[model samples]
Target: MTDWWLWMYVAAMAGGVALFTRWRADPRGVPLSEYRVAIAIPFWSGLWYLVMALGGGRAEVAGHTVYWARYADWVVTAPLLLVALMLTGTHSLPGRRWRLMTALVGANVVMILSGLVADLTTDGTARYTLYAIGVLALLVVYGLVWGPLRAHARRQPAGIAAVYTEAALLLSVLWAGYPVFWILGPSGVGLLGSTTTSVLLVGLSILSKVGWSIVDLGRLRALSDRGHLTVV
Candidate 1:
């Protein structure tokens, strides 16, 4: 990735920040947990994107064309994304502690980082082993989302429940595609060429990160309008 191709990633990341900037706070000063988490989601994500945008995309690891900058971006932003999901439920599921949210966030980070490690591993056996571990972690992630999280959302108001359910679904589907991007790249399965991988990964990142942020923003605004969200 060089020149315009490389700059494309920068543009995508920077544009993501721009999209989320509009919602960094409740313009109306409503004090909702969703507003807080919603604001934070993009701020950290945009920060990581900026970091990745500045850093090196290529690394000399296993000749896999490692984009460690992307890994760095995920390591930090992934947890914030999970926490954003939990915040959607703050008012609906008020009695819960952060244990579940924290655990889920940790699991999510482990899942992606492990996959990155696997992709970077030169040894085939070790790579597959790490990949399996990452897959297991993702299963656990979905189990939590569809299990307790889904249950709680169901008990929320109809609007909140709808938003949470759709948000969870969007998040789960998009996040799951990361490994596929890994596989398509020169890194993992080598199903695609380097340029192709970069393009697809860029598109995927935009949809997952920017798309995820937008879904939550619309949801939060809806809650605010319905008087379900609290005032900040």
Candidate 2:
């Protein structure tokens, strides 16, 4: 009923619709793996939005009660999905590498669980541990999967290069933005801290995805110019 709750619901519905549209469109013309990962974007985004909306319905914090689920979804779940999409989307990656992809997804699952645990735990230490695990999982994803994919993208066609570059930039933004927001934002008791952190993270995550879409569009334009593909 509150403004924060209203924002959360709206964000969730919007994200869900966007993701569904993306899935239905399937514009990439890539493998199933890529589609699988891509489909997750909206679902997770919506879920986080819903969670925050419900959890902080009438809660107040630091002069406001902005829904923070958007941040959490963006920072934690969205990144995991993005990384998965990138890895699977890479032209150079072999099918056998899917095992690694699966592992990465599993790590993301853990991160999601960690977040939930943090939310549920009353003890400060336990919550922090869960948060730490979520952070570490993301780090591993960057170090192991995203790192190699970036290198491969650099060597691929300009279109691929553009996509990967955009992805990299998005990841970098997410990596940098989250901690800064958390450290500087208002601190309060109960759901406020985690929710706020989540909202900030989600904003960054959306920014990164938008960046990728822009880069991909540019790459398409370049490719069209080269006469490799006809402009639609």
**lDDT by residue for model 1 (17-56), tens:** 6655555544433344544554554455555545545664
By summed lDDT, the worst window of 10 consecutive residues in model 2 runs over: 183-192
TM-score, per-candidate, Cα-based = 0.85, 0.61
Write out the backbone clash pairs for model 1: 30-231, 30-232, 31-231, 31-232
Poorly placed runs, candidate 1 (over 4 Å):
1-6, 25-57, 228-232
For candidate 2, give the lDDT of residue 90: 63
lDDT per residue, candidate 2, 1-232, as tens digits? 3346446544654664465456446444443444444446655666665665565423443354444454466555554555644652465544445555566667656655665555455566776677778778767766654566566666666665665666566665555554455434432234445555555655565555433443443344345456533211
Clashing pairs in 2: 71-198, 71-199, 71-202, 72-198, 74-202
Cα lDDT, model 1, residue 185: 66
